[model samples]
Target: MTLPFPSLEDLVNVISSTVDYIVNIVYNTIRGALIDFYNWLMASIEWLLNYIRANLPFVISVVLTWTALYKSVTAENIPLTRRIMNILTAPLFSMFALSLVDALLPREIKLPRYSYPALAIASVYAETEARAEYIIRHRTGYVVEAEAETEARAIYSLGS
Candidate 1:
């Protein structure tokens, strides 16, 4: 007599087909997301490259300005003369380099004439403020203590 239930072979085939369908769906979904991500990444890179190429002079100017700001601000523990020189020369050199780059590269955008100088001035102001705050916080207490000790010694000597 024939069995009422499906045969083992038929059951195995159904399960195998179900697993294959699920795997294909998952694989296609992951593959599509990866392709989209790759396309987006490539497009971003291409846009960045084109922007840099088109605005090479402005880019150079910005880089030079930031370099000058960094050099001037980081010159903290140096001698007065050296610090002055650093503060002065960094911006000058940056401006000169920017000018050179502007001349050398074909520009689609022009950097403002006053931008570097303004940024330099702002950096100097920031450095000065930092130094002032440091002195106020770190040196004021020592100065007050030294003066008090000197006065106390003088008073003792006079009493003796």
Candidate 2:
């Protein structure tokens, strides 16, 4: 019988050379990709920083909220009871708004988990409008503004 054999040292050298070539190619590719990605990220960050710094109003808006718009009392004719009801319901409306936000916001994005304040100044007018609607629908003397004004003058004999 005839048998063929390969030298162990020659086999090892061939495998070693092939592995070294593969490792070099992979290392260079990964290193180049990493450097490019890092440079792109740094440039993007610098651009964004400069943009925000140049736009003072944009920067301020990022820090400010819409709460200032709803803090004033705009209704002069609504009954005190309705006004008080609006005030009391502001927190409930804010809760609904936060719930809506949670429901609508995409889950994959970080929502920056925050506790809703007991009430937001931003929802105050919305609460007032809802209360006004309820009052006008279920209660007398709280009808549409024009009708209420006519009725009020009829009773008080002011503009009759």
Summarize candidate 2's per-residue lDDT along 1-160 as a digit string, tens digits: 5348667887999999999999999997786566556656665665665554445443333233233224424667777787677766665565565555545544432111111112112223545552211111111132222224334333322211
Instruction: Count clashes in each candidate, considering only residues at least 3 apart in sequence or on different chains.
Output: 0, 0
Best by lDDT: 1
Task: Provide the lDDT at 93 for model 2.
Answer: 61
* lDDT digits (tens) for residues 102-143 of candidate 1: 677654432211000000111235455521111111111221
lDDT, candidates in the order shown: 0.54, 0.46
TM-score of each: 0.38, 0.34
> After aligning candidate 2 to the native by TM-score, how far in Å is the CA of 157 from where it should be?
83
